[model samples]
Target: MGEVAKIKKFLAEARYHHQEATSVDMVNVMKQYKGLVSNLEPYVFNDGTCRKLTNLSGTIPVRYKGNTYNIPVRLWLMDTHPYNSPICYVAPTADMCIKVSKFVDHNGKVYLPYLHEWDASKANLLGLVQVMITVFGEQPPVYTKSKAPYPTQQAMPTASPPYPVYPGAATPYPAMPSQAMPQPGGFPPYPSMASETPYPPAYPPASSGYPPPQQTPYPPMQPSPMASGYPPQAGVGAGGGTITEEHIRASLLSAVEDKLRRRLREQFSQGTAELETLRRTNLELVQGKSKLEGLVGRLDKDCAELDKAIATLEEKEAELEKGLGKLSSEEPIDIDEAVTTTAPLYRQLLNAFAEESAIEDVIYYLGEALRRGRIDLDAFLKQVRALSRKQFMLRALMNRCRQKAGLAG
Candidate 1:
């Protein structure tokens, strides 16, 4: 998978994320650390809160002395990343030993000014990496382990020293490796143990840019027989013996083992990347399922409401059909007779009320006509006043009739 894709997947699969800003910052940060391998790993905090957080593990180039060396390191992004600083550590290999210094502790945890003064707005992984490279150059975090055998404590005759010792010195000691001296500008050069001797080369630096660079795995350093704790060969042995079949077999087996180990390491890394991708896919599937379930629930609710509305419409349609049939069966009636009141007194009141209603409609129409310029304003006023007087007289008569007929006005 692509580096960006891998970084996104790592964030998505992480057990906990404090905020969106953290994820956004992580994307940009991961781009800078393209050489590092990103994955979600469980981390236990001081308070015993175990959480799976995104981590970038691998080596970054540190220029020490006059050569560049890949320093193995790991960075863990906190749940509240960008806002909080990431935890960093020196990851030494089996053949190497950790060198405790001001920047690195006995436990391999890194400490630096940049990390201590981390700013959410300005501080980033790239800056932190640069700081690490500079600090590690001054004081290398790790060194190759010595494989020389220990001498017996048996008392023996003391021989003259091959190398002259200084005054007050009990025994001669090997010269200390020269410390890296910074140049006028740029980073300090790195020291290489394999440079002087025929030891294998360390891992190379990973490329980084807008277009993600590929990670080229460096060949693992092969162990020299002298340092590998292997028995002396041929004339080198105490008894000056020739090369044997057993020795050849052992040598061949070691070479095969190294090849197998390198292959297995590559395969393991590939499997891990694929597994993370699968986890991301699974998470997406689960989210999609939840959305589909919610949509289906809403659809079911809408269907139930529609069913009720359909039933009410059906009832209304039946009532309308029944009324239509009754009207069809009835004979045609005179409009005036059809509207007649039950009693004579009520009939008189109804006629007066009808006249008052008619006058109100006439007055309204006259006002509308005046507004639309259909009648003059003076004629509209005179006609409205007359209609109003008639309407008042008709309303008074209707009230009296209603009282006599014992009906509500």
Candidate 2:
């Protein structure tokens, strides 16, 4: 088996032994060494590492002891086997060497150490080697064999037979062997050698020197019946034992006249029918046009009536507006006259009272004037100014009126 195949087989066994471990442990291991393993981490854990090594995967560079080491760690873990034990290695330098100082004692025997310095550059390389060994067994043998250079046998040339021909026919031949043979169920086969002419006996030589005869032109042909001495017929004569031309012409003229008469009758009948149809159509059209005219006239009359009604309404509206304006103007004049007629009597009664009674009478008259609708605002204001001017005159008038009436002032 191939080295890669054996390594894969070892890894499968190792993975089976480690199958009891949780997927998290595998993932943690891969992630911790991701700098050494790179993108293989997810596949190693999630895909169950056994399958990963079968594909002969790439390496990730891990640094240790101030040097970068390419560690061959199989992604797969293998079960312990007696014959082909799995093995992995970390190369200290480009050339792989084991450093004895970095070895760690496990169970009293020295095994390679785990890198614990936490210094990414100075750690154990043997740890990576041990991990690989735990996964894939030791490498397999390499085989070296070379292949032969060129092909041994060469192709040989062959000639084709002539095509077979039918008994009475000629055979046309191809010039070269590379030309395709005529297929069966196509044309007949070519001629055999017994029927074929020899190359020397085939065609005549060009130097025979005898010329061929020239061809003559053909004569024009004459009409047979006239050349056989048959005379031409005259008009109205029964020549050639047939009917006379005049009778044939008369029959033809009669047929033509009959056809013409029938055509004329048909044309007259069709004209009469067309006239009747046209009359009916004209009547229908006239009726329809009359109906349409009546509808149009009705529409026009209705539109005119609507227009008249609109005009009448507009005139009435204008008259009503004018009447309203007249009423509005006359109303204020009548109100003014009514106020002028009633207001003077209240003022006279207020002036005739004594001083204290006059104040009360003036207030009463002012209220009565307001209530009776006898005081316009402008006139009431003028009356208040006039009363102020006549305050002493009004007192004298009150005294006189009290004396005349014999009442205490």
Candidate 3:
């Protein structure tokens, strides 16, 4: 290769990138954002802030979780478009209510970590959508099909020069030429040997231009080990060579199956754990209820016994009241005779009741007179003599009553 060849190659590469940047009719806007444009009808670059008025669309089939979900997107370029991230939205279907989620709101406002940490100098529309597919995967969109499962989940986190990797591009984001089509899923299927090497088999014509220059003589081509070997080479051609189409397809299938299995296992484990916990909690609740019932039963028994005791006491009170009523209805007792009769009874009771308090009962009536200081010496002597006579009377009364009882018996 000569200096002229290097310059030509550089020019060709530059031309290729230029065409990619302006694939849409809105070259000014597309050049700035490098978006995949959806041109509506007559091709024209939209000049104003009103993005809808422009004949452009950025629809793409986003692949996620092994499902190809078609995300029809529209870009609303801002007045300060390149400096700031554009307002993007995924159009809703007429039949389905779009589920509001962290990444995409019901009204279609996206809240992505990339957007939160946006950098205008290096970000582009293609990169934005690529990241959208990833954020949406965390909580996937409902029911439309995506182009394919993610090219590589690991590819999503990279943000610098975050353009979609076209067939030849090194970066993970979508920066491929428009020839890139949405197959069943994924940006581009793994390349074959021919695609793995970006240049064609034949060399280009020598460059005629000057300012930029490059020249490196090409070496003769050799047969790929893949085709040369007895069996096809391990990958593409050699063991460590670029990924082959077959390998990509096999990997996708295996990944889908593995994801499904893992999901099922997780659901089963979670349900089983919940059931065990519920059973334990239920056991505790039942035991607590049983203990409360026992305590209530004991209280009921005690209440019933108390009620019976009250009823028995009530009966005794009623009987005593009835006896008193009958006594009141009968002739009034001669208090004097009653006193005379009860005098010996009191003495017998006092003698029989031998507790220490019996002596205290003696001074009961005399206490008032002593407190009043009403007894002079003469009065006290007279009262003493009268008390002596009463004692003699009590002795006669008891003897007479005993004789009568003996005769009657």
lDDT by residue (tens digit), candidate 3, 140-249 = 43333333423323332332332232253343222212232223232223322221232211111111011111121111122323333344333343254433444444
Clashes of 1: 7
Segments in model 3 whose C-alpha atoms lie over 4 Å from true places: 1-250, 336-409
Q: What are the lDDT figures for the candidates, one per model?
A: 0.65, 0.38, 0.46
TM-score of each: 0.38, 0.23, 0.29
Predicted model with the maximum lDDT: 1
Q: Assess the local accuracy of residue 143 in candidate 1 as a C-alpha lDDT between 0 and 100.
A: 64
Worst 10 residues of 1 by lDDT: 205-214
TM-score of 1: 0.38
Error of 1 at 129 (Å): 0.5
Better of 2 and 3 by TM-score: 3
Per-residue alpha-carbon lDDT of candidate 2 for residues 296-385, written as tens digits (9 for 90 to 100): 999999999999999999999999999999988874556434543234544454445435465556756976896789887777777766
- Ranking of candidates on TM-score, top first: 1, 3, 2
Q: Is candidate 1 or candidate 3 better by lDDT?
A: 1
Candidate 2: segments with Cα more than 4 A from true spot:
1-242, 330-409
State which candidate has the highest TM-score: 1
lDDT of 1: 0.65
